[model samples]
Structures are given as C-alpha cells and as structure tokens.
Target: MIVATVQGNEKGGKHITVKDGVKIFGKEQQEYINNIYDKFHINRIEIIGDFGIKKIKSKEWFCYMKHPEVDASGRTGIAFIVWDKNTEDDTIEKTIREIGFRDEDYIKFNKEYNKIKKGKSNKKKQLIFLVGLGMGLAAGLIVITLSMIKK
Candidate 1:
C-alpha cells in the first residue's frame, strides 16, 4: 500500500491530524477519495499535487486532504492518510482528465472532483465550462470594442 498524508488546517491556523492509513482498495484513486469523503464524515478534504525533484509548483502530481471540523486543538480538523497501490503517474493523470479535469483545472479539480466521484454527478463540470465560455465571450467583446474605438 502506497501511503500519502492529508493534512488539515483549522480556522485558527493550527494543524489538526485526522486519520491516517486511509487505503484505496481498487484502481481508481480519485474515485476512491471521493467515495471516502462522501460516505464518511469529513469536514473538508483536498488533493494536493507533489512536485518531487522536478519542483513543479502545480497540482498535476500529488494528492492531499483537509477537514474544517477538526482543528489544531483537536477540536475541528482532520487529516486522512490515503493509500494507493498503483505507481503509474500517467494512469493517475489520465483518470483525472477523464473525470473532466483539464490540465489547468488541477487545483479546482481537487476541490470539486469529490462531488462528482462520490455522487456520480457532472453538474459541477458543466458549470465550469459555462463559466469559461462566459469569460471568453466577455473578453472577445472587449477586444472588438477596443479595436472599433481605435479605428
């Protein structure tokens, strides 16, 4: 079992240790995380990417968890130590993408992936694309307006 640590920070900025040794029984690591959060009682959790030797400061390679209900004082913060048996980095990345997380949506993906994974829902993914489209349209209009003014 490959073990990963999930740390949680409380409202007071204190660190709270939740549960460790959280195991992923099957192939789908992300899906497993989602199910754990959904079925179990957790305040908040997130998957953080680790930038090993490459030192990549992005969410493309690591997983983590956080809980808001547990705190540093042992009151409202929880940490879930997850286990993954698969060691293939490519497979993990592929799974993330298939779940609707774009290469750029790593962080946001971590935040919302659980919702879809647990409930088997896709509402959040649709909203993300819709928001992206709206932003693109606004930018296009601004560019066109500026060009007309210059003319």
Candidate 2:
C-alpha cells in the first residue's frame, strides 16, 4: 500500500491500502514514515511549505501526508484542510466527497480551483501577463536589431 507519513492530527495524507499483501513501504521505510509522523504528531515539525521552517527543529517534510486531510463531516460539517507555506488545499467539498487524489473529478476540481485562485482578478496574476509582455518586447527588439545589422 502506498501510504504517506502524517502527523496524528493532520488531515489530508497520501495513503493507499492494498487488499491482501501489498507493502509499498517496508519495515524500515514504514519506520521512517512513522518517525516523521511521530515528530509531527508531537508538533515537533513545521508545515509542508510554510516559511520559518529553518527555525524549527523538525520542519514537517511531507513525502506526502504531513498535513491533516480530515473529513469532519460525521461530526457535523465537512471540513477538509491541507496546509503549507502559502499553498493549501482548502475547499469545502460537502456535496461531493471523494477519497484520495486518484479520482479524476478531484483532479479536475483542483485544476479549476487553482485557476480560480490564481485568476487575473488578483495582483499576483498580473505578473504572468507582464512577463509575457516583456518577453515579447525583448524578442521584437532582438529581431529589429538583427534586421538592421543584416542591412
């Protein structure tokens, strides 16, 4: 089974269980996964991509897992959160709930979500267009210079 290491309280972790006998991570590997998990479990590590990771003794290194992928729907509300530095998979998927990232719809949802999150409505998005414009201008200038040189 492909199971990722995660803190005890963490929610979204990459895990896949097998039917009979399938060990993606063996004893030593599982131990390693557990070690990191234990650290995070005791709150000894930092988040996935959070800043100030250097300051902490154990910066939460996620081979996947690390973050808390929890479905608190049974308790009442469907709350799923995955945190990182400036990145997080936070979308209250109440109506349609699916397990694992292997799902096609989940992938599509994430793609759309990211697109919406990084849409042109935000200031950060303008950088992409600006960079494209700069590249075009530079290329045009280079072509003009080349043509003049040819003459």
Candidate 3:
C-alpha cells in the first residue's frame, strides 16, 4: 500500500515526463518514496529506476499516475504516482478517485478503510454479545442451583 505524491514548486517546471520528472526531482524522488513509507503502513516499496525504467521487483503491485495540477490550457501539469503491493485494487482506485493524492488521499483512504471495517466490527459486536449472554446464563444457573440447594 505504497502511496506517494510529488510536486515541483519550481516555476515553469510543472509539466514533465516521468523520466524528466524524476530528473527534475533528483534527491527529492527518494525523499518522496521515504515519505510515503513513513506516511503509510504498506507491505513493501522499491523504486525500479528513473528514465524509462519500468522494472518492478514485487509480485503483486499496482501503480496509479495522475495529474491534477494543470494550467488553463491543460498543456502544463504535474504528475504523481501511487504504488501499492498488498492493498486491494478497489480500495486504491476508490481512494484515488474520491480524494486523489497527497493529503486528500490520506483522508479519503482512512474514511474508506473505516467504512470497509464496519463489517468486521459488526461481527465483533455479535461475538461480544454472545459471550456476555453465555456468562450471564451461567451466572443465573449457578444462582438457581445454590438457591435450590438451600431450599
């Protein structure tokens, strides 16, 4: 579940190819990957390389690249990549579609994850209720036996 977003604040350097983007980013690229690791609890993440390098080392992985930053003419834009190996594709797609990358992505992912977790929570609640009911029944049975013995 490696999700990363990078922005080049340099003026007139907005739109660029991934290869050119990596060059423009330079050390910042690694910093971005590191930041993603720090930000998310993903299974694994590794940078294949820059400049037309598409070598992936993971067996199950997904990548989403999008450009939300664009000029009026839509000619210039900044692109970011979100990579993940362990997370579900639907989860990733929903997150990207609903909130996009960067801070927005984080918030949306948390929200969606919580929603998906609701099913498990219901099951937990049912288990807790059953345990409590069994305990109460046993306590009642013990009280009845003790009272009957006294009688």
Candidate 4:
C-alpha cells in the first residue's frame, strides 16, 4: 500500500486527491481505516473516486468523527488517502505526526470546518430575512406616502 499525508488548510477547505487503480472501500481497507480512526479519534472520513478527468464521486459508508472540538472550530482537518497498499504493523497516529500533523491539529482542523459551515448557514438565513424585511418596510412606506399625498 502507498502511504501519503495531506496538510490541513487554514480556511477549513476539504482537500481530496484521486489516485488511479486504487479501491478505497474494500472490506479489509475499510476495516483498517476504521480501526485507525477509532484509535486516534479522527473527525471525518470521505471516500471519493475519480470519474475520468477531474470529476469524482463520493462513496457510500463515509465515517464522520464525532469530535466536539473539531465540530466547533470551523477549521479544516487533514486526511491521508492510501491506495493499493495496506498499512503495516505501525501506529497510524505516529505516521500522521511524522507527516507534520499533530493530533491536536487534526482536532482543531475539524472544529474550524464545522464552525465555518455553521457560520455560512447562519449568514444565508440572516441575509434572506434582512432582505425580506427591507422589502416589506419599503412597501409599507410607499403606501403611507401615497395616502398622505391624497389627504
């Protein structure tokens, strides 16, 4: 199996890289990845497949890590996608650290992503409500002005 490490982004962006001739959700691969995530308490696992030249597809059975710290931060997390190989007898967390990712950093990344998503949702709702309110007030003012002119 190939071993690779991904770096976390500051803006809570999800980064995905596709490799050819690799299956991510075979029985053994899923079990192995699940075990590692369980041991280290990862926040989310997204499996994507390349759809010929820049398109990709999300696979079923994606695992979401329920880390409250990550859930609150709105920061992005780091994920390493291994293909065509199995993990050897080594601690997965240690390997991740060696790739310049601290355990705490991963948690923080997850938190940031969650926070950003929440903030975006909230902003959309607020903007729509404000726009509607503004339109209503404007219409009401126009009606009152017309009545005063008639009087």
Best by TM-score: 4
lDDT of 4 by residue, 75-95 (tens): 434454332213332333344
- The residue ranges of model 1 lying beyond 4 angstroms of the native Cα positions read 1-121
- Cα deviation of 15 in candidate 3 (Å)? 16
Provide the global lDDT of candidate 1 against the true structure. Answer: 0.41
Candidate 2, residue 44: Cα displacement in angstroms equals: 11
Q: Each model's TM-score, in the order given?
A: 0.24, 0.26, 0.34, 0.36
Q: Per-residue alpha-carbon lDDT of model 3 for 54-136, expressed as tens digits?
A: 21444332333343454455542323344444656565554444333456544544565455457657988999999999999
lDDT of 4: 0.42
Give one digit per residue, the lDDT tens place, for model 2 in 69-109.
Answer: 44433221111222233333432222113223335544554
Q: Using alpha carbons, what is the TM-score of model 1?
A: 0.24
Top lDDT prediction, candidate number: 3
Reference-based TM-score, model 3:
0.34
Question: Local distance difference test, per candidate?
Answer: 0.41, 0.38, 0.46, 0.42
Tell me, what's the RMSD of every candidate?
15.2, 11.3, 12.1, 15.6
- Worst ten in a row by lDDT for model 4: 51-60
> Higher-TM-score candidate among 2 and 4?
4
Using lDDT as the measure, name the better of candidate 1 and candidate 3.
3
